[model samples]
Target chain A: MPLRWPRRLGLVGLALPWLLPYAWMVSTSFKTLPELVAAPSAPLPSGLNLDAYAAVFEAMPVGAYLLNTTLMALAIGLLQLALALPAGYALSKLSFRGRGLAFGLVVATLLIPAQVRFVPVFTLLAEVRLTNTMTALVLPFAVSALGTFLIRQALLSVPPQLIEAARLDGAGELTIIYRLLPPLLRPSLVAAFLFSFVYHWNDYFWPLVMTTDDSVRTLPLGVALLREQGTGVRWHIVMAGNVLLSLPALLLFALTQRQLIHAAAGKAAGR
Target chain B: MKLLSPRRPTDPYLLLLPTLLILGCFFFYPLLAAGKLSLYSWDLLTPPRFVGLDNYRALWSEGLLLHSLELTLVFSLGVVTASTILGLALALLLNRPGRLAAFARASIFSAYIVSWVSVALLWLWILDADGGALNAALQRLGLPGWRWLSDPRLALPSLAAVTVWKLAGYAMILYLAGLQDVPAHLLEAAALDGAGRWQRFRHVTWPLLRPTTAFVTSTGAIASFQVFDVVRVMTQGGPMDHTNVLVYAIYEQIFLNLRVGRASALVVVFFLVLLGLTLWQLRLWLRREGAEGQSPPA
Candidate 1:
């Protein structure tokens, strides 16, 4: 097919609506207060300004939010992977008396949205005084039914002869899972990890519900707090804070774009 | 098959223990707890006193439950309908072979990958009543600007617009994958048979895309029903409760109002609604698969 200019312009027109918000976000973040007030609708800033970024840091604990978010997302991802691996392997490859029932139970859990569990879980955490702590943020999501389901689907695609050969060589189940399967399942694992990481990193509801202390707040909550300061709101500073909050996830998306898209598409196709 | 059996009868159980333990503590227990707590009235300061069915009656009589459910349904309907149609349109546009297409795909999908708070805050700035980018642009275009968020009538729609923007890209990716599965030979054959462009899509492409459409719409509905962060950040259930969806309403009942029993009742109702939706989707999916399996190949 020959490339037509009209077609190209039309495609750009379709894409512009999606892309402009991001461009505007970056542009507004770099605008000085005077420039923002003067040219609110201007697509570009006249000069680079670090003052908004500086003001965000001055107003909020950006460093602590960064650290907390990073640690929490990392821990959730690692923990979900750690739990999902063996369970998915067993559910996929191993036969047992209650295998069907166990798989059914896991699938059933998927139907129960996390919102329904928040009140009771919050009470349970508060009873033990775990609220305002990292544990409260991490515990509820330690085991991901969806992750296990995805892993199980991925594991089912592995050649049975490989696992049979390992069994013939007297390798234990754990050895096969940890050693042999990891390499073959790397894409699925990474996909699972990225989903958990991004979901939690961008998660505001859980932290908002679980932690009231500023010290324990994550990046999204921090950005929200910036807005909630109320009256004389600094649009530039708020955008700057949003930029900081969004950078890591956006960078991760850029770096792993292909794998992420493939995984998402693959999952949707029920592959 | 025998080779796949565990070394010990206990091996599978042990492998599943950690997952079961956590799910039991966090998921199963909370579900039952929510049920039991719904019957009792308690603030954080006092001992629980069981007032059986009163909480349910209160939510029903006060009319907040029905009102929030209605709001949530309207909000989700807008989000799901718009996201599905827009997503399919985007997928069809970007499904071609080119570098520009790929870049456009990435750019559109980037919105789905970021946090809701970031998206919400960005829109909050853009939709500000005065000095906002959108209003400023409107004035420049010689059109009057509307108060997007503060106005009761527009708040829910504004939130839905933000949501659709975030989600349409995601739906596009799914539809793109779905489009890939549409057999090329079938399309080529249809084209060679003198089928027009719209005819080819209507007869060949549209039928093949049903599964993807179902997946996109179902998941979109579920996510939209559970929307919280955007509503919390952008409107906080609104200037006059216009955007007060179910989850936000539940949050307010528990955290803000300290009505634990009432919130638990609301939570139970929310879970039931979600459960019904999930089962309906599952049935739709399975029925579609059944119908597809029975259909003759073109």
Candidate 2:
């Protein structure tokens, strides 16, 4: 803890590898196309030129990509929460036959990553003529095993007496779950929602496989396609598109750093 | 534990039904379908033709499957080892209570939350063979500029480096959380016993962080095994297919090659590998928990 300034400087030095790319990204995004071509590796742009940003917006449907990604991520989050809340509550608070089996089933599904299932899932959707639609993006991710598990862990921390007291007051099971438990489970719920939102917002693999239409293509895919369009690499325009793609997740991280870090740690601990 | 006056046997099941249904349709069903589809050759145009064991045999004979598996293993190993070490180091350095430490933590972890495509494009720009910032910096520093992506030998390592960059922050956050639970009293006790700083950390802190290390390494390995977007965007598993991790290979098989049977077989293999890894982690976790339960109080 001594020599605090030196240590802090050293920490900043170490952080440069992680921070520099983002700095360069934003800097490059603001560079004019001619400047970008002239000095591709320049640390700082000449000035805050908006030519690349303008070009990117003109060339690609940046707004639509953002909106599609946001709507898809929101729908996935809400659906996961709606399904997971009851499932978590049942698994944690309620006792019944086959409860252990049901919980085990949920946990077992965690072993299968979506990457492994995408091929068949893609085919199934294509059979139903659902590919290239928003529903295709949302439906497959509707139930999150991790969300259910996390919520279950959160619910287990709540005292049985509270639910019992509610029961004594003749509160319906639906009311107890939908009303009382959600307030107490706010941290987990928020964590689940944020995780789902950030994950799907940034998801490229599923959207890449599911949708070829620009209408349903998410931001990440849109940015990737932006790079592939021209004869040569347009560094400035690509960087501008990337900056746009990264802003939402970065903003989310900034706003909810503590919750996001804790949720991740809780996941690692397998709670 | 019953919250209702008359315990309805089906109440919990009713609550669980929606979740189970979705998982069944989307998760478990597709898993089984992947297995079944592996036995039959199907293109989008043609009906699936049964070719029992042929897809697996063909992959095994061609050796692409094994090669992809090896490349993935190597990639995952490099990523896991590098990231876990760097992550722990970052966690240790940033664990202090101060604004600088907090800022450092947040800044480092910011990369982990960004989309892989963005990370890929960002790195692609940085690692561009011609006119890349990294090469430009190297030339400015009077050093030789190596092809970071195009070279067969350097490409895999480059992708691994990018992955490590993104994932080390994730591992660091987990290690930071683990460091918080290292039981300060134990460290103090060790200090009281005349242990040096290294000795105390070696004996007390390292031993306590075993669970976190296991979690980080296993999860990192699992994720690295399935890396796709970076490879898809940056390399396309090119420069002699050096960077063709399993997932990308599976993707190529399905979409590009239109060999559904082969892709499904690869998926089955990938799932089995993941299942094995998960089972191994579960065993490690259970053993650790058991040891903790039986250990005498300090």
Candidate 3:
């Protein structure tokens, strides 16, 4: 499929706007303070340096924020998967009363994003005195509607006979689910995990509203505070913090582009 | 087929228990709580006091809510229009199979997954009034550099621009997926019937992409309304409340002002608006998909 030269040029030209900011971020992150101040518009620094990276740590508790964010994201992802798996399997493979209603309720939750319920959830957490805790970050999102829907879609394609055969061989409920569903649902699991991980990791709104102290602040919040507090903030150092925060999601995306794309594209692939 | 759950009628119920319990507590309870809180006035220090519809009345009479609502509309419209058009155009351009096209798609889509914090901060650097990349480019082109965030006129659009940059990739992926289902024979038939490229896309391709467009636009609208981080970080609803969107306004009301009732009222209003839009989208999707046979929801 040969694309016309003009069309190809247009596509590449359009793509540059998206790429340039990221390039500029990486470029500025390595610039020395003098170079950064001297040429803020410079597309490339005169020489690469790690001084800014070092400054990011000195400026704030970036390490602590990063650890908290990583832990929160991981906990949310794993918990969401743990809950979504059985729910998905039940919807797809098991016959139960009110299954349609349960599924409908799950899908209906999609209509209301977490932002809409921010106040109540915050109040509830505060009432429980769990504000500023890691649990504050992860508990609300432990059972994901989107995760359940996707996993169910994935499981619908799996042949029910396999589960039946296993059950007929004296396999218990746990055995059939654990032994048969894991391999079958691996792609959906990966897709859901990555989605949850990326969402929770970069999530700033929830963490911002929930946590007041630097001890509980995530990287994004840390960067936000760095900007707010540091009146004469250094762009290079701040960009270094931004780069460090974005690196994991970027790396994961690079490694799992296929699964991520498929996840968004839905089961149109019919896989 | 063997009856896998012959002896376990309650197996499905057991499996669904955790999900129901969690959602009931966190989701449903909060939903009702949000509603109930909206109907009353309670500063944390004071006992709860019921004020039927007064919060809602104050929200409107105060005018801040109205202003933020208008800003939110402008913001969502800007984002949806830019993302959908750009995304469709890019998807059309990259629909062809090739290494370069795939690379282009991947690179463009990468921005969608990057943290909003990073994107916001990076753009903060790029759009800085004096030393930013954008202004520098303007100077090179013999135009004066403009203050992107500081100017009230430019602040909202500037945030909208960043949003478009980040979200256009997501729209592109959805459109690309939609494009794959446009049967080759239908396209060829249209071509043979004297349909030009634009005509083909307008009549056949675009119509076929109704579901995708619906999904993209609806999701885009909701996501844009919920825009908090970028505004919070970049403008802090500022230069003159030009970038004060709904979610940010709610945050300010509840957290900054300690007006829980007002915040909850805003939440209820926002939820109703989104719910209306979502139901409309679902109706359109179901009708379109039903008419077009059994196409999967994108």
Candidate 4:
């Protein structure tokens, strides 16, 4: 009820505290070790000194890893959407049997930490000789339990009169899904797509455990490897690589967080 | 009419196809094989030997697994409780009208996109104990500087703090959604009834927030139990394995120690713990819904 400049100023003041670490991360990444560990308060690096990034590249193929992650995340997101959309339409719109059991099973799989089967997956991959392949990175994740459920829930809410009219016009299941359902479900689809994109992009455990070779490393693992040799780790190098690993996802999320969060609320409440 | 039904006839099988096939290949088959493998002792480099529960017996007698289980619980409980409560508070505060609400929300969220690896890498420096940002700030404020990640006594809490920082933003979004759905009229009525802010929150707001609470809490618990990245990057189950959690131990068992059988047992036990908790939640939730349906919305 008053001009509470103190509270307003305090909130802004507090904001800087949280952001200081990120500022440090960005600033230190550009600084030399001497500058980073300086005795007194250090000024932010003024220009491009990519020594940390160069160290990251020399220790491992950080570029190839970024490429691998980009390809893997994009592939998994695209392929999962392609399959999940049609199948979700069928699940939510079509009168199919055993749907409960199927939904239950899909939901159950979400609970199972994919880590629980690490040894078995590793052994199976080894047996199939798919180890160290990007296929190994992308295939298992191409089937997303959450995406199917999300799209299915979205489609379930689309008015059935429209579906009936389309079918009355003799539009096949594929057309109904690809044309009618997806358009109405665009909000939900975008939500699911962003979730899937970020999920796979940030996925570290499977990629770490699965791919031993630098040739197939994703961005997360690439940054992890950048942090250290056996003796000492350079924090600046690791932070630079962290920024690289995260920037794309961060950009996408910043652009779509409102839409994504709104859709999530819509879908969750719709259920 | 048919579409309104949660299940469709053939769609269930089709809905299940991807999850089934993938889980079969990646999860179920491996799990069952790991079960079978657990019964036998194998180095994995050579032909497997059929030891038939010798590994289990040895594990029971050794009680090394009991140690890992304790660590796992500590890791999960500490991280889950801190993150969920604090994250929820941040969400509620930022959910109100403010100039910085949008800015704070986005900043917290930016942390989410960064991988756990990145989060750990960043905090490792921030918590570097000597000249890192954390210590620098503490010392400048004339506070005693503590080694955040390296000190064995404080390492686990240090790990928990970093994780909470990383995840609080995501939880904030979940709660922000929940807060928006709360009917403003109900809060106004409470205010008219002489309810203080805390009382209004406790009575009018908190109960309405249950569904969001359920979703966030369940997801948080599941994620925390399966936590590997933070531990791997920050501690590596280290300062001499003082921080060895279940999944990390499972990693060490299979990869480092080459004990596939023991690792499988750890995983199997963990699955039971997670699945058991989830089923318990579902049953309780259903019962709560059923009981509440008999009452008026007010």
Question: Could you give candidate 1's per-residue lDDT for residues A1-271 as a string of tens digits?
Answer: 8789998888888889878888888988998888877767788888898999999999988999999999999999999999898999899888888899998888778876679888999988899999999999998899888888888878888888899899899998899888989899998899889888998999998899999998789989989998898467478889999899888888999999998898778767655
lDDT of 2 at B252: 94
lDDT per residue for candidate 4 within B1-298, as digits (tens), equals 3653323345446545665687678766777887888887777788888888787777778876787778778877887788779768887666656656677767776776677887888788788877677788788899999977777788877877887887777677778877887999999999999999999999989998887677666666767778789888888987667688888988888889998888887778888888876775565456546633211000
List, residue by residue over A1-271, the lDDT tens digit for candidate 4.
Answer: 4327776665555456457767778887787767665642354775678987787777777667778888898898887887788667656665556667766666667666678777888888888899899888888777777777777766666788887788789886667768877778787778777777787888889898898887788888877777655355466677777777767777887788787666545433443
Clashing pairs in 3: none
Candidate 3 C-alpha lDDT tens digits along A1-271:
5778987787677678878888899999999888977888888988779999898888888778889999999999999988888888888777667889999888877766788767888888888999989888888888888788888777777787887778789888777666778887887788889888998999988898889987888988887676776666388888888888888888989998998898877633333
Q: Report how far off residue A133 is in candidate 3 (Å).
A: 1.3
Fnat of model 1, as a fraction: 0.73
- Model 3 chain A: weakest 10-residue lDDT segment is A262-271
User: Which candidate comes out best when scored by DockQ?
Assistant: 1
DockQ score of each predicted structure, in the order shown? 0.59, 0.57, 0.58, 0.49
Please tell me what DockQ candidate 3 reaches. 0.58
In candidate 2, position B115 carries an lDDT of: 92
- TM-score to true structure, per model: 0.96, 0.96, 0.94, 0.91
lDDT of 3 by residue, B93-212 (tens): 888777778888998999889889888998998999988999999999999989999999999999999999999999999899999889999999999999999999999999988878
Clash count for candidate 1 is 0
